[model samples]
Target: MDTTPPPSRPATLTAPRLVERLIQGQATSDGAGVRLTRLLTQDLQRRLDPFLMLDLFGTENPGDYIGGFPDHPHRGFETITYMLQGRMRHRDSAGNEGLLVPGSVQWMTAGRGVIHSEMPEQQEGAMEGFQLWLNLPGRDKMREPWYRDIATAEVPEWQGEGVTARVIAGATHGVQGAVQRDATEPLYLDLHLAPGAVFTQPLPAHHNAFVVVYRGELNVAETLVRTRRMAILANTPGSDGVLLRAGEAGARAILVAGQPLKEPIAQYGPFVMNTQQEIFDAVNDFRAGRLA
Candidate 1:
């Protein structure tokens, strides 16, 4: 959909990673009965280190999202929300507020703690988006809360032969993304490909990666990844990158990769910590009205 011209040089890959397995998101409801699919569950936390959860919410019925997400708390992690359609208003205890429209992104760091609410701004129509949770290291678990709203135009993109890549949080084809994290070195890309198009991305062999196709289908390493499916990439030795080919109907997908922290992960509901004692402290803090 992005008409931006292709970069002069395309990525080169000596060995492309293969799909380890396919995943189907579990149908679930959250945030006041908002229908959604949980792509990354608690069981996969260890496999997808530094990345905790990934939820996809999309619906045309107002009743499904009308209630939206009320005041909720989060700690010891960050939340990156990418709005694909509809408008949602975000308000937090830190006096931060923003309107999330289609193509916009909100990156919030609930380091120490924060209470926030995401409510729909539109009365009727479609609401579609994704929320990805990125874990915080032990050292930064108690850091101050931070938030940012990146407008649609701020997100950098790159176009090639028959594909367009929106770099959300990492470098691709020499184009820097809207947000970058030094701790995790996360790569979040939204790719739109024309029918039969081929796209290549160089990736670090150590990082954990996966691709979720939302529209049409994609072929990776000779594996057919259908729409609404996620393909977990194998971290094979000497693998330098990944090669993706769009199906006949074209495709739209999100490719995410991140360096593993390799640290112990302790989680309880919305609170995440390194140790059980830390989780207890978080619970006590929230109960004592200390968590904001």
Candidate 2:
């Protein structure tokens, strides 16, 4: 595979402009019935450029999950949910309800508005998933609503050395994922590593790149980042490899990159966009039932 970095930064997004970091934080959402660990937000938000949020949820027992997120509203962003071990049931005011099991992903675009509820599917035990909120460019806000349910087989996967990589979106190893996006060409990979593994992937000069190590340690550029940690990358690139390397056994991470929209991002709760007016409009639209 051509793991070649762009010779020069893309005019659209450059190293100095695109954001990256090892952002880390625990979930603190309102009255929680779920176990949500925040990997990026606040300053990380400013650094993500075109991406907004990443939340990891996991539980081996239902009681551990206080409950599940109920009906809520959102606008001007895309919520991409990926399942890892268990299943979750989803229902939207759009009249969509279904079960998502391991390997299933739901990409929902709440452009103008959408109201939905997410609850865990009961089984013997365990439930896990991640939700990535991707910002939509200003022009697409309120454009319309759409949904895509991508199965595990649809994602691209490749392996090398002591590590394995699954591409949920974007191209890697000559294979591409079918997941769709509205802004910033993005890549999402779920990585697993055995003892002492080294991993490398090229980034478009202008795209933002970061890694969230969920289970173990990642030595990025020689900095040790442990579990539940986000590693924001430096804007500089070199042969010493401004990259990430896994440490020890059972290390795993999610690597993401995307071209920066290079636009102001105004976000409130689950809504995201470019201006305060956009946030207001999104709130009004949801309250007025436009989400239906």
Candidate 3:
């Protein structure tokens, strides 16, 4: 007697964030002539709020990255390095040292100031990774400098339908990343999707989010994002998350989101301050041996 088809399951309603813009990273030399692709930087686009720069470095030639990033000073911000392959050794004036191997990360906060160097641990083989800069709040700009070295085993992995997401700096699907800097409340994830896989994750309503594809293609917000391309997603009203699907060969990308500080930024070289005078003070302090 019950011939009626069961009511169709309600389709999961996504918040519907769109790709507002797509940017292709440009090849450039940085850190003593090390080659990399600059993506979502202050010069390339608007200040991505609290995010300053994103660099993807990859090379098989030892000559390209062997030079490495030598002693440099940073103030009023943080630097995050995520390694996919190869090894990098970090040393700072504070007497801290770390070795970042594949699938590892080094997060350093240059609140007041810090001088550090990153050198390649090996001379050959393919090396690849990303470095992101996150701004500190005005109140925290003069705080103590700190660092966190996270090994691959420490990073949590979230598993969903055809997707494996490595949480690096935020919570996703009950998995929380190892690095935690409360000032910016950032979310960094490395995601891998199987062919035809669909993935979705919730984000803070006010956080600014973007996705950078490094391998294969992905359908993000109905837009096809290919390798070496970035998709800046719209923080649309009522949007609480993002949706992405993989192409025939699947996809891999890094998703980063953060709460904006909305403070005035005065940056010069490696220093970021709230005012031009502060920047001057920073530079002067660094030169006068007051910066640490």
Candidate 4:
């Protein structure tokens, strides 16, 4: 049926743009009980479209991080958090809170607005996680607040020669992502490749694909990307799609591909909309405490 989108050669970023990692910066939290950093905010963004923000946090000593994000407010976008290890308990003022273990996924649609919190439940075991922010289209920005909590058993996984992958939010191979919403047809997969392993996945020719390396080293085209680095490949450099491989040491990374929204982006903190007035209205609504 040719349902799959046509694919083209992957494009490489300009010299000023090719990058592999983000440096830690002054820390802040979404609210009183949360922790956030400037991974893809403000000047750090624009590298990826329909995707924003990646936060990494952990509490190894237990006392330092036994606590997690307490109740907070969100609007206009979607939030997806994946647990690599440890247990995370999340609750919202909407009366929804549950624990998420390794390989599990929590997807929230803070359409208009919602208040929530995530905290660590177990003190002994390690606690580590990654959170990503996905923007909503103008038509669906204020639609409604919804959420999806998936257990480790629900998401699909594949293990092959020198590579392993966990499908968190989008499709890959033959299996598709579990969550279905008004997204930009994005694919999110956790990939672990042994040393010197090379792989390539076809992407929609009209879409953009990027890799975010968490551990070890990665090679994007001819660029060398070390741990905590991100590489963006767009416009299809060749008709063959993007190629990814591990460096001397094995590598762990996240691969994301999605169609560009191509819309004007207006974002402020937790809110993202199309126009300035909409942003103003959102601010006033939040300040007035009308968001629910």
TM-scores of the models, in the given order?
0.97, 0.86, 0.93, 0.83
Clash number for each model: 0, 7, 0, 16
lDDT of 1 by residue, 1-292 (tens): 9996545445778899999989999999988989999999999999999899999999999999999999988999999999999999999988899999988999999999999999999999999999999999999999999999999988898888888899999988888998889989999999999999989999999999999999999999799999889899999999999999999999999999999999999999999999999999999998887876
- When sorted by TM-score, best at the front, the candidate numbers are 1, 3, 2, 4
> What TM-score does prediction 4 earn?
0.83
Which lDDT tens digits does candidate 4 get at residues 1-292?
A: 7795443222342322233443444466544444544355555445567777777655466655655666667878888898888888888877887789988999998988887888777868676667888878778888889999998898887555677778775665566777654458878888888898765666666665667787898887667877665666655433446567799889998887666677777887778888889889988997888874
lDDT of 3: 0.88
Residue-wise C-alpha lDDT for candidate 2, range 38-135, written one tens digit per residue: 77665666677778888887778766554677888888878889998787788999898877889788888888888888877675587777888887
Q: Which tens-of-lDDT digit does each residue in 1-292 have in candidate 3?
A: 9995442221253685788889998889988999999996777324467898899999899999999999989999999999999999999999999999999999999999999999999999989999999999999999999999999888898777778899999877767888776778899999989898887778766788899999999999799999999899888888868888999999999999988888888889899999999999998999998865
- Deviation of model 1 at 282, angstroms: 0.8
Residue 158 C-alpha lDDT in model 2: 73
Q: Cα deviation of 63 in candidate 4 (Å)?
A: 5.5
State the weakest 10-residue window (summed lDDT) of model 4.
8-17
| CA RMSD of each candidate after superposition | 2.3, 5.7, 5.3, 5.8
Worst 10 contiguous positions by lDDT, candidate 2: 9-18
